[model samples]
Target chain A: MEILKKLKILADSAKYDVSCSSSGSKRTNQPGGLGNSASSGICHTWTADGRCISLLKILQSNNCVYNCSYCVNRVSNDLPRATLTPDELCELTINFYRRNYIEGLFLSTAIYSSPDHTMEMLLQTVKKLREEHNFHGYIHLKAIPGADNLLIEAAGKYVDRMSVNIELPSERGLRLLAPQKKREAIIKPMTFLTSNIAARKAERRKSRKAPSFVPAGQTTQLIVGATPDPDLQILKLSENMYKRFGLKRVYYSAYVPVSHHPHLPDISSPPLLREHRIYQADWLLRFYGFQADELLNEKNPNFTEDYDPKTDWALRNLDYFPVEINRADYEKLLRVPGIGVKSARKILTARRMHSLDFDDLKRIGITMKRAQYFITCKGKYSGQTAMEEHLLRPRLTLSPPKTAGPEQPSLFSFSSDVIAPEDAFSSVTGEI
Target chain B: MLDFVYDGSFNGLLTAIYEIYYRRQVPQQLLSSPGQTPKLFVREERIITDETKAGKVYEAIDTKISSRSLRHIYYAYLSEHMEAGIWIYHYLHLGWKLGNKLDLLLSDERVHRIHRLSQKVSMERHRLLGLLRFQLLRGNIYYAALEPDHNVVELLAPHFAARMAGQNWVIHDVSRDLAAVFNRKEWVATDFTLQHRLELLKEEEYYQQLWQEYYNSMAISSRINPRLQKRCMPQRYWKHLVELS
Candidate 1:
């Protein structure tokens, strides 16, 4: 078949994978290669639906042998399936790279024929690019769930980044949604990679000659809202993956309704806002010094629809706020609802030069409206008189609608009505 | 009042600043090029740059201000600020009064403008490090060119050297008529009166054809949005962008 005709069918089928990030790989040009891979950063270009199409985001083939209920590319779907030869894909990548159309390639595929068959084709494609074609640009390859360890390791050596989509949070969910896939198939490759990373590090420690192994590290994506898994369960799983596997990232994709299955919920699509909230919470867990337990529990299993995860946290832990601006440690300063890393650093830096006051906080660009309830500037409060949820909840919810723009009075007018930057700090729990 | 005329380089500006301050004479009119006349009734005295006088001025400013501040002053001079040369003189005067807190003057809108201008120049330097695309010509020489809005060509030198270490490459700022040439080991700037002899590559046309083919191949006709593409890659920049061009 013609390359363009085959590519369209394959890419269209591959679109539902929802793991198009080309970030977190850091490889540079070698002697014979024409390009390099940047670390954890891809020039992400998104479509109108906010789909990342920056890379040649495509599947090598869509001729699946396994029938997964949730997947549109399942064997039952009788779609116009096609596969590209390794040389065809390599030629296309070089052509595209020279034109500056893409930073790199994000290649994934369905289990065409078998897991080994799919992975072998992917391995050949990447191997040809690195060895024969001398194509040095970024490559993010997908590790087929049940692929052989040798094939998986071989795939890692050629590409900058790799991922094996968790597909579902739990094994129960996996069985119900994707019957052919197993928990061991997904976890084994991850465990092998985790051990491989350890072995590579040890090799490096013993001798300086050891080559880099998946320099960007492995990442996985879990389909949120697919199973009966709560956000708490998801976060717990995410936290464990970070601690256990040393995974670089755990991308959470809110499920998009792609099929009309009898068992699957008839929800149109997973709420985009919920997906956005999960990402916010995910960032809090990763960057902000918050643990999954700290953000959620049995009582607060899901993120609040109205307020962001951080704000939600700050409001629940109201007593922790009113943190002293000049005295608070970096971690404590970070916990303040409104204070971001940039602002916290500014506060720390500016305090060294001069003793900070309420006016000084404003000058340094702290969004006092949120921070006032949580922090104090020179023993003064600049937030609301009522830190109680009844008064604060309405004010917080009303604030977004009331003063969302330039037409409204300045949001800063609450300084006298409140007290100091301290009083503003604890007013809300803004995590994300 | 003394009027001093010097070359337009950063060192020339510093040497002129040194002359005025140490000589204990304020120039009513300072011109970069010779033969410029100031308004009538303003006394103009030309001060020739002397090594001793310049050194004393440099030492005093270095002691009063800071080495970091001095670098900022140099950056401001290179910024080609509209009234930057004159502003530097005023800033030095402010520093003399303000002691170590000379940066307090940075709060002023005029000084802020200089800082903003310098930041703009610095930001372009950072972005170009990742954004620059190099193409290999027929002669085995790599030619990468840019038209950045800031004077970031110098800042881009160190990064490209480390990244493209073994290769012979020419990074040319087309608008500035300056090129940073990395020949095997050493890198240096060249301002050629005649254009560079680097042969135009047939590789470009090859890449261009491939890129156009890829662009057509990737674009979903079912989900075409020229408006979104235009938003991400503006029409103004399309002529130089290898994909669009």
Candidate 2:
């Protein structure tokens, strides 16, 4: 088959895995290297889905041996199969990098023939890209769940990032959908990679010449809405993963129903809003110092679809609010519904000069619409007549209707504009 | 009200700023040569671009303030905002007083304005690093043309130079009529204009088509949000975007 035909099949197959970040690594260009990975990832283009396309996300092959019900390339599914030679993949990456089409490659594959065979092919392609082609570009390779430990370790040296997808959140979910994939197969590699990365870091501290191991660290994706996993369960699992495995990111991909099975949810579309909310709660867990129980619990297992998780948390815990903005510490400021990491830092820096009022808060880039009810600037409340739950709840829940007209100039304006709470929510959370 | 006008260059702006401190008189407005317009009761002073005076101000900024502040000042100059020169003057004045702590005074209007303008310029430069698409021209030279809002071609050169170290490339800021040429070893900026269109390689056209095909195919049809897409990447940048074009 022609290369373009294979790319179409492979890329289309790989589109469901939405972990597109090329960040956290800073690989400089060698004297004769073709590319380098920036510490902060760059999005080369935005797809029609409004998601950033940063990497050449493609699979080595779509041929599968395992029967994962939620996947498009499961052995039971009769999709067209295609695999690229190691040389073909290298040439494609170099050509694309030269044309400035992508930052690097996101190479994934299904279980073709066997896990070891698939991983070896991936290692060969990445090894050739690094050694023969002299490509220093960001490469994100997928670690086959049941692949050899030595193979995974060797491949980790060449790629900037690697991920072993915990496709379903729970062991029960994995057993029901993907019977061949055991929970141990996934967690073992993550544990191994995490320990090895720590060892490499200690080695590098002793000697600067020690080569980096998975410089960007490992990230994993969890398929939301595929199983009957509650938001609380998922968040708890993620929280544990972060504590245990030292994962860089836990991407939440809204499960798109690609295959029809008796056990799977009979929905036509993915639960994108739920995925988005999970990402919001996930961000709070990662950056905003919020725990899983703080965001949601057994009684309230799901996040509200209207207001963000932060707003929901704030509304639930109203007594915490009316906190004096001037006197509040950084942690207290972060609890406000509208202030993010960036604005919180801005407020901290700006407040050192003078006491900040509501106007100054706006200038420092806080979303006053949501934060006003929760904060008092200089012992004065600028919110509505009463900070009652009924009034505030309705006001916060009402998502601003999409503005009609030629695109607003404010949309294209610089970063200092009063960030809409939803915009802040989406910026940190990956787009659908 | 006095107006100090100078040649439209970063050094010229610094020289005007130097004059403001030397003369012990604050100009109501600092204008670039092209921005200057005759007005009643406005005293206009044509400040020459003096490298020595500009160097003094630049070195003082590096000495008193941090090197990061110097970068912010240069970025703010590249922003080409109508009030950028005045803002930079005020920022430098404050920097001289507070030394390195001037950056911490984000609440000060002058400091905030300069910081915001510099942030805008830097953001655009970072965006162009990814958004700028190269088309393979004759002689295996990768060429890209863009019209960024800020004068960021020079800022973008080092990044591309590091990435494409073994390849020849030219990034043309068509609006400014300036090009950054990287010839496999070192990069140089020059005033360049296209006299004739060179025929692109056939493989280049084929690859561009393939890219468009991949881009269209990759998007999930159910979640097509044109508003969000426009917000992330404005239509102004679409003309030169190979897939969108």
Candidate 3:
């Protein structure tokens, strides 16, 4: 197949990096503009793996100069290589946009020659999309770490969200696994983006018409279970990243063993449960007002497979439990097991009208199965057993099998109960 | 049990609700025209779809309850659930006294039922926003065909009209025989039919092929979870999706 026609080859190469979130930017369609970005983002489809196909996530080119060992399109690898021209990229994005196949384009690339050339190619394609095609859709362009700051800066203006992947958590993992990729090379571009994104916001504050730069801010991804790096190390790194730089999200992809390198762990399947736990912890940090240290400490560096990060935190600190549902503030409600941001808000709202009971809690959409142990409605506990770590630990551990199992996922399909509650935000009304 | 029949138009539904109030009769079922006949001996009345009465009820919901409640009632009505009319009646009956607080009483079965049906309809609307696939017709019209759970094709028009302001498009909800046809200036929802399978442009096929190839290659084989995929985009929606075929 011609290099330009090998859409599958480039897409397969680009599929592993999982940062498809298209939210944060609200670029309205200009008069006669071909597209616009929704503030919350619209997920167009779900791929077979169940991951959302929100954007046309593709690479500009897969022929690489640097050989990252974990990557499918490394220099030494013999995979089919292809490059989409700037016009080809625009055409595909516009055609897809017209058909509602995607929210926007998620353009990344392997270092085809130098980082500068590759970044320029990405920048060129996005600029053409905006200028020639009059497209205003969400664009998430990946920043090449070692690329020049000018190219990165130029790319930011045309894109909604930009990301630089810190694939390995620790510098030591970076040294061992990817010899060519220095930790400083990645950090330098990230720091630049962090400052520039901030400066542009300050400018927009002064003048609303000042053109937005990376309106959705920036994001980064870390490969989990790639090395012997503990979950503590991963969480700590994410904590520092969020605090130090105002990044939007830090995605954790369970390292799929693409090749058998001596440095890589000989795991049969990706550690999806660990990834899910880390994501749960990450959510707590971002939305639920929890710190990394609160969830994990040095004494227990790794998350146990027995419980989720929140449940583990609740169990370790039982003193915070038995919070009175009616009187407990929003923060206290959040700390309780199984009370998510939505449910916590629900409890607060329902509490105003009348004091809640266990029955009311259930109606308010609280996950009573897990929450029954931690909370008291009308000062009455509803757990099957008393509120002790030994008693609750057995009950709290997830009974439902992981969505992505350790072995081939098809062997033990998850029951409906496990799947139903997901992203349901099923907490029904209380606009009251 | 009292049964109310009317045209399956939103205005007609509102007119039924208006009659329910003026006649001081509680209805057990609200059936749309050409709808199923009521069982033997059930009191049935066909309501005339009066824009004037509907306008009055629409204004009353906004003034008495909040505009938010108006949205809830409208969305619940669109759900076309069998008992939605009765629930809305119960909701409005209590809402007259409780006003805005009616929704806040989440524990109330009537209020909760209205919210739940509305949620189901809106969720499907959000899904179809992402799932509706537009193909280019031979006449340069961007055409899409879908069978949404609720009548959301009209709802989806403003978004597409803003995004694709330069182009003419038609979003046809095949199940209901309704289509949202948009010219550059404005859009209208009207009765439409396909007559036959749409003749798409040859380039439209090429783009769909490219999209299919891209979609297929995007999934990581190591983490393939058909169950999750099905949950998010169920099998019922796969009929119109080009990538699925």
Candidate 4:
């Protein structure tokens, strides 16, 4: 097949992986290299689906030896399959890099042959891009789970980030969907690289010229809504992974129904809203001071589409409100519903001069509609309703304010009529 | 109300600010122009731009207040908003009065306005760094043309200088008739225009086609959201992107 035809098929096959971030790498161009990684990654463009296209996400080949039911590139699927030669792949990367089409390459593949052979192809292509082509750009290579540890370690030396998709949430799901792939095949490489990355980081910190290995660290993806896995189980696994594996991120790809296998759920569309909630919960665990059990317990096994996880937590824990915005410390302020990390920092900075009122809070970019119920400014509540759960629940769920309420007070007008003192007083009142 | 008319350069704006403090008079406007109308009963004065005075003022801000505040003033000035100069004058005036705690006064309208302007300008610069696409022209030169809302072409040059150090390229800001041309060794800003049509390499069209195909195939059909796409890559920037075209 022509390379153009191969590119379309390969990219279409790879799109289901859905971990296309190019951040957390500060790799600079070598003395004669062509490109570099921005400290805060750059998105070249957004696709029609509104996903950032930061990298040239394509497969080395779509020919597979395994039939994972949730995947589009499974063996039983009768679709056009193609592979790119290393030289062709390198040529496309350099040309695209010159034109600024992508931040770097995100190279994944189906198991074209045995796991060892497929990994060898990935390792060679990356080494060629780094050595012969003099390319110092960001690369995120997928580790063939059952491949040898030596091959995984060698490839880590040349790429910014590497990942092995924990294809299903649990062992039973993996056994039902993809019987050929072993769970140990995935966890073994993850454990190996985590140690290597830490060791290299410590060595580099001690000496300026020590060789670096996977300097951008590692990340992994989980297919949400694929198995009958509760969000509690998924989040607990993620929290454990973050601690045990030292993983950078745990991506959740809402199961897009690609196959009609009996083991898989019969869904018409991807569970996009459910995926979004999982990501929000993921962010809270990583950035905000929240634990998995705190956000979700046995009784509440899933996140609601009505409110975010933080707001849900606040609604359940009523005593936490109404937090005094001026007196709350940074950690306490972060727990409020509408105050994000950025908004929290802004409030702290702006409140140092004087206690902030509702007007100043709005200027500082707090989402007062949601936050007003959870917080108090100068010991005064400003929400549309009182701080009762029943009173505020519907208001929070229905986001828009009243369309035909009393007109917003004009900027020049006071809340109460501010009559002139001369007009209010009887100036010439003298008893006869 | 008093007004000062000076040349529309950053240094000139700084000189007008120096004159604002020299006369101890607060001006209602700082007009840099061939055509600007003053309010009724307002007096106008022409101010010459002095490099020495501008330097002294910049040095004082850098030394006394903070380098970060100085950077904020510079970024805000690049925004080229009509009232940016006057707002910056007020900010710096307050900076001198407040000493080191100037930026922390975010509740003050004048300081907040300047911060917003600086943030806007820097955000545009960051966006253009990613959105600007380079097309390969004849003679082995890479060219990109953009029309940003702010004067941000100069700010993008340093990043590309370190990025594509071995190649020759030009980043042209068609709206303002300016370009940053970088040779293999160094970069320089010069007046630039497209007098006639230019030519591209024979393979340029093929790569552009591949990119468009990749862009289309990457977006899953079930989740197409044009509004979010427009929000991230605004419609104003679609004119130059090959994939979008």
For each candidate, what is the lDDT?
Answer: 0.68, 0.86, 0.84, 0.84
TM-score of chain A of each: 0.88, 0.93, 0.92, 0.91
Query: What's the lDDT of the predicted structure labeled candidate 3?
Result: 0.84
Candidate order, DockQ descending: 3, 2, 4, 1
TM-score of each: 0.77, 0.94, 0.95, 0.94
lDDT of 1 at A95: 58
Superposed Cα deviation of residue A353, candidate 2 (Å): 1.5
- The true-versus-predicted C-alpha distance at residue A391 of model 3, in Å, is 1.4
- Quote the positional error of residue A317 for candidate 3 in Å: 1.1
Candidate 2 collision pairs:
none
lDDT of 1 at A114: 71
Task: Please rank every candidate by lDDT, starting with the best.
Answer: 2, 4, 3, 1
Error of 1 at A71 (Å): 3.1
lDDT of 1 by residue, B17-91 (tens): 777756777775455555454546555444455566556656776798776566666667656655666677777
Q: Write the residue-wise lDDT of candidate 3 on A1-432 in tens digits.
A: 653367888899889988887899899998878888988788999888788889999998899988777878889988888888999889888989999999999999988888888889999999999999899999999999889999999989999999999999988998888899898999999999999999999999999999899999999999988878889999999999999998999988888878888888777567666676678788888777899999888899887666777889999999888899889888888888778887887777777678888877777566777788888877788786888889888787665555664544432222222433352112111010
DockQ of each candidate relative to the true complex: 0.18, 0.55, 0.60, 0.50
Deviating ranges (above 4 Å) for candidate 3:
A1-4, A400-432
Q: Encode model 4's per-residue lDDT on A168-189: one tens digit a residue.
A: 9899999999988889889999
lDDT of 2 by residue, A124-234 (tens): 999999999999999999999888999999999999999999989999999999998899999989999999999998998999899999989999999988898989999
In angstroms, give how far residue B200 of model 4 lies from its true place: 1.0
lDDT of 2 by residue, B1-245 (tens): 88898898889998998898899989988888644346888888899999999999889999999898999899999998888888888898888888888887776788888889999999998889899999998899999999999999999999999999998999999998999999998999999998898679998998887788778878877566676778788899999999998
Find the candidate with the highest lDDT and give its number: 2
